[model samples]
Target: MIAAKRILRKAQRQLACRKRKIAIEEIMESKGDPTTFYKLVRQQRSSTSMGTEFLTLNGKTAESIEEVTQTWAQYFQQLATPTAESTYDDLHLGKIQDDINLINQICNSSHQDDIPTITKDEIHTAIYKLNNSKAADIFGITAEHFKLAGPSLITALHCVYNRFIKNQKIPESIKRGILTPIYKKGAPDNPGNYRGITVTPVILKTFEHIIRQRHQIILEETQSRLQTGFTKGTSPLVSARPTYRVHNRI
Candidate 1:
């Protein structure tokens, strides 16, 4: 009877494992359904907990919730802290000063018309381009909020953005963002194993979108064709094709 029970338990475990494999295979085989694949992957994870409960810092394990939170905060704060700028020799420093003076002269000589003002249409286009269902920033505002906002809000944004450009200033609140630590493979307690993903306010993102759209053509023109990374219409393959041809000729 004991042997029979052991055999039955083994069969049941095997059956469960087969079912899991079949489910994953089905999810993978389904075309154009990344959502289902990600759902299945998430479900398979042992823990989806975002809590820093198991975190360790400075050779000490954090015990309480507050301590864990503080540890995470300290870790991220250290990462965000700017490093000291490298000192340049007198000759290099003088050359940098000359470049700065030239830039200042150019800016002073340029007309106000050179800087384009923000328009309501640009704001509308930016809002439409924003992706929905994203995590909110420190202000608890998401892309969906901007998308669903009325025309009056667009006009208001246009006014505010124009003011920002005119005065060359932006609100500190807009600069603030929320950092979420996502775990990468490693010891769960190690802070270095996680990468911080920053979410900024939707308004700021909208403004940036408009700026990028306005300057994209000029920026793309200025960039070299060799710059495949982060550039549109060019990828690793596009860069490699030339090298492959050269190798073939050789």
Candidate 2:
């Protein structure tokens, strides 16, 4: 019995040594590339916290992986789908005749000439601006991949965007998103504790960036001076500075 226990302890020690060697090798490789280091760290953190094994559904615990996945699907479906009894009442304002007229005038105004076609420079700018460490969408393409791709790839993407703009339609691939549920501050077992964050394709984001550029011009022309948030070169701090000065004067 003593001999057998000694052999088991020796095997356990050998296994632990092997694991430590592998971990050391990974760390050494990651040190050469900061991006790889960040990715490895993120994966390690996600593996520990993100698990579907302990999910609760309909007052019962899911036993299998498939059951847990299905439960999450059902939960999201129910949350997205509106109940038959759900209704919205028409909103009425008693004294907003001029406000309504101004809104109608702005909505009816034509601004076709302001819209610009997608250009290679814009695509390149957008690609470089994309975050490298973000999770990829369902297509398994990351922004870092695009950033490394040569100018030819940017040109190709520009052409694709122009084609999409000409058709006045976005492809289904662009519209598709992967929903990842992130746990908030609550019980781990409860589905309500999690919030779904949609990860969109990097290519779609490039197109959005081009569109935003055109929209920004129109917004600058039409948007009220009081509205500073989400505009270029203006933030909440910039908007609050004038208000702070006024308050101090009073």
Candidate 3:
């Protein structure tokens, strides 16, 4: 019995060594690709605290992987679907009403003819601005696909964009995105503890970049100087500077 236990322990040690070697090789191979490298690192960890397993909802326990997935889908769907009882009666009004009116007036008075049409050059520029190593949308399309596409594809996109602009309508496909639930905190089994991150199509993002680029001047002029969050080349830490000074004075 003692001899048998010794042999089993030796076998387990050998298996662990093999796994360690394999993991090292994979990490080395993925060194150049930051996305894959981080993913591999995550896999090497013993366990994750964020439980994606929908063990139970209400009183019913999920029996299979499919059931768990379905439960998550239903939970997110219900959250997205607005209640029939919902109304704008709970909202409050102040000077915001005047601001809304001003925006509406500007939009109504804007001339469609004065707006410049989408061009191939603009499409190329937008495509170039896309970031690398992002999650694909529902269609399995990534930013890399657009970045590597030739001039012919750029011309095609240019035409499609202009057509949408001329008709004042966007295709339904462009608006679709895939939502991934990321665990935040609290009970892992509870869907309420997770927030969603939507993966939008690269093409749709490129089009948005084009629109933003066209209105860059206006946005820069109208944007508040004190705002730091989400603004390019500005850090959220900048907003903390004033708070830090106030704390020191106090």
Candidate 4:
């Protein structure tokens, strides 16, 4: 259930980013000026957040991911006005509906068999692999980077992801509710901090290679703050300090 939420939230960001990028390109094609670009940035927040899931940043915000998603969907429905006359020709409308149908089958279903299983990590590994293996040059940014999960998966997901973003960035509205795993910051013996990790290309490629050959993606267990700062004095019962990563590959 938790993994499902991550998949949903990440999906929103990924989809919204693509839409935003395309919109920017359309605006640029008209030679829109600096003012237009500034306006674009200002409105970018709404575009990204609207009809999309968001991790609540503060306490006052509602904690329910489902409520937030429903709110977004309602906003989109209200905003997407129907036209009496078809703006899209029959052929175009058909294609659009087809695409929507395909995505719906893949993403929107309660039955496991009905919906194709596409995991966030699997998607990340696919995009990262593609990027390293020539797709990045073609697309500029890898899909994982485009999706903005690389940093979180590597360093912060184990900790920085508050209860909100960790498992429920994307809430599954139709299927069910969201569940957050207990955030583990390590024990008293292994308290620590993670200096931001600079992911090496080799490691990134390793992820791609693993996925390519094994048909599975493995996110290496990252050393987080919990592992580093643990002190024996904090826990008198332990004979040794808790295991922690001082540096690479602990």
What's the lDDT for residue 106 in model 3? Answer: 88
- Candidate 2 weakest ten by summed lDDT: 86-95
Compose the digit string of candidate 3's lDDT tens values, residues 1-250.
Answer: 9999989866764565455456656766887997896465545432442224344676776746699778877888888896645554434444667789998898678776767898888999999998777666678888889988889889899889888787667899888887655544455557777667677888889999999997876768899998788888898899898989999999
lDDT string for model 2 (97-200, tens) is: 56888877874673534446777888887788787776776788888889888998988997898877666568886888877665543555678977676778
Worst 10 residues of 1 by lDDT: 43-52
Backbone clashes, each candidate: 0, 0, 0, 10
Tens digit of per-residue lDDT, candidate 4, span 1-250: 9999989877876776566456545545534464464344334334342222342322233226676545434433444576556566888778988999998886454444432333445444544554322123122333345345555554432232232223333323322212111112222111121011112233244334433544321212443334333332234334234433333346
Q: What lDDT score belongs to each candidate, Candidate 1 first?
A: 0.74, 0.71, 0.74, 0.40
Q: How close is every model to the real structure, measured as TM-score?
A: 0.69, 0.65, 0.66, 0.21
Using lDDT as the yardstick, the better of models 3 and 4 is: 3
Count backbone clashes in candidate 4. Answer: 10
Ranking by TM-score: 1, 3, 2, 4
Model 4 vs truth, CA RMSD: 26.2
Q: Which ten residues in a row have the lowest lDDT in candidate 4?
A: 188-197
Q: Return the top candidate by TM-score.
A: 1
Q: Given candidate 3, what's the lDDT at residue 147?
A: 85
